[model samples]
Target: MQPYFMPYLGYFQLARSCDQFVFLDDVNFIRRGFINRNRILLDGKPFAFSLPVIRASQNRPINRHSFAGAMELFLEQLRHTYRRAPFYGPVFRLVESLCLEPDMNVARKAAASVAAVFAYLGLPLNYSFASSHPAEGLGGECRILDICRRFDATAYHNAPGGRHLYDVAAFRAAGVCLRFVKGSFPAYGQPGAETFVPGLSIIDVLMNNAPERVSRMLDDYVLEHA
Candidate 1:
């Protein structure tokens, strides 16, 4: 997975469910995707927050893109957005620590957010970037297969969104099993909403609920075999 900006609950679930995650930061950066942006709750409604990247392009890799501007406005937005939530103090601090890091590369920033959340929840899974170890393949499925083989993996787990793309026979032939994780955001109280909006960023989850509650909620998903 490419690093995402304070990704959704399902992203954390996918990480926690794995022993290790290889963030595919070396891959081509997808526009209009979750690489540098995520949905958060603002004014009790869904709002998208994006980390502006400098000269981001599909031709270039995610790790090559850097952040565009000072993070003050982004910080202010988060502070104003979740200030009144139940876990405001802790959540704000977490976001502050992660986003304000000196590293301005978008991949590092996004990965920092993921690491911060994982640490906050005491999740034990480890992670590395895809660029660190180049695997042999040129395209999507072949690249994924090469990655799995490079790590000598027995099984591969992907987000449910990749259901159509990952072929069962291909993985089986490589002596690896494939599975997809499906997560429905567990029902939780938002500060000012009558009905909860689902699939907001990890920031929303941290703001509205305690870490322990979110930790428990992380397990509220099913893994389907391919």
Candidate 2:
């Protein structure tokens, strides 16, 4: 699916639940979508963190977009916002290393940063780029089906919002099972008595809890047949 901004725990759950996770970077419609922004809580208030993108032709690979000019500003914002977090030091160091590494491929850099974070937290999954695949004109359900076929996936899993867009009948006709992710809140080790904010970015959890605690939080989500 499309890359979302440091997406929620459920997104990682979906990634781990599948065999091969595809990043739909080639899709053009959701330019301003979560790929570059995510929500975080600071001083008990909700806020969004985003990255500035350099302009490029539509045909340019998402992995090629650059964040050169805004790197320092973005790092400063993250440091200022998350400095008080319980896991701030370690997370900040990781972010610092990734952001400063010499790389003009902005999309790849971001993807690598995300992968590194997930890896640090012990979530393992094979990630692939949709642009690398031989997709010509697939869209909507057809696109999902194409991925399923390419990966030999008998089941196609997606987030809850997918129910509104996925054609279940068509998938059934193609012999692929459709499934939706059901988020189980208040996963083990989540902060006690705190007002739960559902669907915030994973950074919220990382900042509020330790790595082991976050691992327990993974248990809170389940995949259900759609």
Candidate 3:
């Protein structure tokens, strides 16, 4: 899966369920996508925050994309939005550090943020970049198969959205079993919100809830045969 910019709870659930996770850094950057943007709860509503890419081309891969946004400005937004959150102090620092990182590439920055959050949550899943291993394949499914083969993986797990993209027999032919993960993101309290917003970033989750609660949320998912 592509590394996302402060992705939602489902992303963390996928990471937790996997033995090793791969971030697809070699793929083209999809503008206005989760790669550079995510929803964060703000004043009882879901609001989007984004990292602007510096003169990026759609043809360029995620590893080649550079950020053109101000870290202070972004941090200020987070500071005000999550001020009342229980874990704001720690999460704010982590988020600030990620935004101020020297690396400009979207993938590297996103990977750094994910790693930081995993550490904070004590998640033990191993993660790597797909670009680190040069791959040969065309379509999405073929490319995914190549990744599975590279890891000598006996099984592959993907988010439920890709259920149609893969076939059971095709993966079996490649010596891999395929499965889809669908998480039941139960509604949780957000400090300032009257009603809960389901798809806010993992940061939002951490800020408002205890680590134990968030860890339980990571386990609130079902894996289906693909």
- How do the residues 80-151 of candidate 1 rate in per-residue lDDT, one tens digit apiece? 778888999988988887767778888888888898887888877589888877865566888888878878
lDDT of 3 by residue, 1-226 (tens): 8888789999888888899899999999898889988988766788898878887777988899889856676788888889988989988888888888788778998888887888888878698999988766565888888888889999899898888888789899999989888998888778778877888888899888888888899999998887
**Best-first order by lDDT:** 3, 1, 2
Q: How many steric overlaps are in each model, in order?
A: 0, 1, 0
Q: Point out the higher-scoring one by lDDT: 1 or 2.
A: 1
Which stretch of 10 consecutive residues in model 1 shows the poorest summed lDDT? 130-139
lDDT of 2: 0.71
**Clash list (residue pairs), candidate 1:** none
Model 2 clash tally, residue pairs: 1
Measured over all alpha carbons after superposition, the RMSD of each candidate to the real structure, in angstroms, is: 1.3, 3.0, 1.3
lDDT of 2 by residue, 43-77 (tens): 45566777777774456656657664466876776
The 10-residue segment of model 2 with minimum total lDDT is: 187-196
lDDT of 2 at 224: 83
| Residue 57 C-alpha lDDT in model 3 | 78
Residue 144, candidate 2: alpha-carbon lDDT: 77
TM-score of 1: 0.96
Better of 2 and 3 by lDDT: 3
